[model samples]
Target: MAERKLNGGLKAALEYGPILAFFIGYLQLKDQVISIAGTDYSGFLVVTALFIPLMVLTTGLLWALTGSLSRMQLATVVLVVVFGGLSVWLQDERFFKMKPTMIYLLFAGVLGFGLMRGQSYLRSVMGETLPMRDEGWMILTKRIALFFLALAITNEVIWRSLSTDAWVNFKTFGLTAAMFAFFLSQGRLLQTYGIEKDKV
Candidate 1:
């Protein structure tokens, strides 16, 4: 069966929905939570408490609507459940804060493994929209693997040293902008290597 085309905007929403939801929910509930919890409730804690289940539900709904979940999506769901559950169970918001770092590293490792196996799993996921030759796919996969590793390291640094709000902003917008810039820089190469419609 031919793969269904994903709407870019929908894809973006699905990818970032959890983070956005968490931020919005936290902001909305912050004062109420503080008042109820006797001023001892950290914003991060309030956010995580609400974020985890909401994310899981959102992801599941997306999967059902899409009719298929990509490997990346599957991995994300697993990680969110595991880490999010840990955060609630331990009553520590640190697990929630580190989720992005874990996700990036996990993707980096998966991409690296695919490269070692001479397969471009990243290409497999994106191939429909961004088709390319095998060589192009390999190069793209390697580059993205490295990019994910960098993101993981960057997340670690930000979360460990920066304030929670700073880290959240970086995760929500800064990192996304960086990824877009990186992809844009590769436009020329992608065009050169892209599979033509007739050829496809």
Candidate 2:
């Protein structure tokens, strides 16, 4: 399939739209309970159920429309199926909640492994759109890897130590805000390295 290069806006929408749907799905079904579970069926399960199909459909739509999918997008769609399915099947929220941690760790691990092997994986994945020198790519990769690791750790803390509702709030709002801040913090670095003009 020919790769249809996505603009930053569409990429952001594709990445975050399903996430926002999760929150909306949760709220829409917050008070409803599934009786089959006999006890633990809750809003979390509803959202998880809604999430699986919604995400799968969204990913399929993206692929059908764009004729391309990124590595990260493909991985995330699979994770959503595995974890989200498990969450609904088991009538437990933990599986769903852990999805973000796993994703963050996976990215961190891949990037860290690349750095260990003396490769800037981010540059390989994003070089055309996010042009940078070797040094800039190295530095950006390190910071992004660390940031991803931090996000994983934070997800662990929030999900493990808080109520399901609180965790959802943190996942939808806190994480989103933090991600925006992280990108903002990299503005000078992006400027220094010079993102591709067409991309910017």
RMSD of each: 2.7, 2.7
TM-score of 1: 0.86
lDDT of 2 at 95: 92
The best candidate in terms of TM-score: 2
Task: Name the candidate that leads on lDDT.
Answer: 2
lDDT of 2 by residue, 1-200 (tens): 88786677876676778889888888778888767636657877877887788888878878977898878889988998999899887877789899999999999999999999999999878887777778889999999999999999999998998887789889889998998899899989878877566654
Task: Give the whole-model CA lDDT for all candidates, comma-separated.
Answer: 0.79, 0.86
> Which whole-number lDDT from 0 to 100 does residue 112 have in model 2?
97
| Superposed Cα RMSD, model 1 | 2.7
The CA lDDT at 155 in model 2 is 96
